[model samples]
Target: MTALIEAESVKRYYSNASWLQRLLFLGGSEIQAVDGVTLRIEKGEIVGLVGESGCGKTTLGWLLAGLEQPTEGAVRFKGRSLGNIDAETRKKVQLLFQYPRESLNPRHNVRTILSYPIRKMGHTATADITARIHSLLEAVGLSARYADRYSFQLSGGELQRVALARTLALEPEFIVCDEPTSAVDMNVKVQILKLLSDISREKGISLLFISHDLSAVRFIADRICVMYLGKIVEQAPAQQLFDHPCHPYTMALLDAIADIDPNAIRKASLHGQPPSPMAPPAGCRFHPRCAYTEQVGTICWERGPALQPLSTDHLVRCFLYPEVSQDPDRKQ
Candidate 1:
């Protein structure tokens, strides 16, 4: 069966130098933001994409949402190319920006903000638009009284809820939530997560939740994908990944989190900064930071390991599991 959304070996690159500069051997670099990534999101499932900053999480989200085109591959919605989708189908995919204040227009009030998408999309009657605006606000836990308030007048949490209401107004089938809770307080973050999860369940909407917060991802995601630099290092069910993380990067991230035992030693085993995307290492991008690289010898430095299946659903891109048999059904 086809997934609701699929990114097939997509790559998005940005060149800092012009054609003339590159020809002259001048200063130029290519940023491999999203390199050779293949991901699938089933309908109504929340897939959390967790990684450090500059790991291309946002870029991949944009590509998946059809807000940005991939340089090499294609993002498909239900087996159809995003570019070939009609306007109505396009509306089914939406992006929720990380910063709500910046994404919302200060000049417009909450009602106007929510009404614009509705009006432009298909709602022609003022009465229907007004009803939808209020309903969306209510759905996000906002009162109808907030309808007249502008973005500047709202608090950070309120602004985020308003932003979510604006998105919900479109009745999208899928949403790319890019760090939705990063700008809000802890309590508000919980509210946003609950609201998102509830909406996805009630409306059968698929979501790609991008964040560095492992705890949050564990709470809301059915599956988790760990990215490093520009490539996915590991992917598995949320519980499986947290319980038995296969990749060194995933282990380091889990170890770095605060443990319940205050006396327990919990220093992250992984060390060193990530290599630059523009000049990634010759072999595995994470070889320099992986503790097990020495045990693997030059194999870690001379050849990039493919994303191999450790179990039926768990996949890790590393050389530590050379003995594991390749499963054709779960091949990366």
Candidate 2:
């Protein structure tokens, strides 16, 4: 399978505001929002990215969507490097933000919002924009009557559908969905997730679905990537990941979910907030909070682990599997 999107050692950093404040008083430090991270998504497949708040999931999504550029490394789409692509090619990869209310223009009606992208693309005639809007409205489970409605006139779910319609207007081959259903009601969230799945199946569009909701990811993703700090600690088939999570961080996350079966024994919860990305912990970024840290050693503190294959499809970055390590002395 060909990768529709790939990120190689991507990194994004933000200098602390204290630098400015330092002019008045000495204090504060910089922040590394997204550190070295790499991932890939095959065509027509959905890959879910999950982590706690401020874990750089949204930043990774934006990078994949081309809304933001990486400070280091490269992002490639459809066999072509993103940096080499023209604007026309870039439009084929779209991003859907989390907050529909903030993403949509309050003053613009639904029709205008949907038609804006169509017109900008120069792909349709002005006379046909209204018809296209109606078709899109229906495609996303919205009523044609809402075409003339303003952003505030509709409910949260309705606004999200409108946003989806606008994204569809571009006819993108790949989409980075950043927490698409997080702000909506549970019923609406289910509808939105089903709608996304249906659209992906029907259109063969590849998706990088970013969310902190593990349960939702289980339902929609073919594969899962568990991120910690600024790095991916585990990647595996969705079912395999949930059933036999290899990374300690991944297991901690599943344990933290409240709805797990009562008969199943729970793993210990991850304690303490993740360390600052600016100076991420040495070896394993997750070692500090991991209950399985007993298996890690000084090497996990002095050197970072590379992603290594566990099973045919599962890949994890941890010293627990020393057989995959490059160091002969460390090889199990």
Cα lDDT of model 2 by residue, 1-332, tens digit: 65788998888876665656878775466566677777888878999999999889999899888877898888999778897798888888998889999989999998788888878768478668888888889999988899899999989898889999999998899999999999999999999999998999899999989999998899999999988877788999999999998888888898889854777776677888888877877677877887766756677777777877898899888878865536543221
- Regions more than 4 Å wrong, model 1: 22-27, 260-263, 323-332
Cα lDDT of model 1 by residue, 14-100, tens digit: 889988998898958899998889899999999999999999999999999998899988999989999789988898899999999
Give the distance in Å from residue 166's predicted Cα in candidate 2 to where it truly belongs: 0.2
Check candidate 2 and list the clashing pairs.
Answer: 283-300
Write down the RMSD of all candidates, one decimal each.
2.3, 3.4
Residue 322, model 2, lDDT: 66
TM-scores for every candidate against the unseen true structure: 0.94, 0.91
Each candidate's lDDT (Cα)?
0.90, 0.85
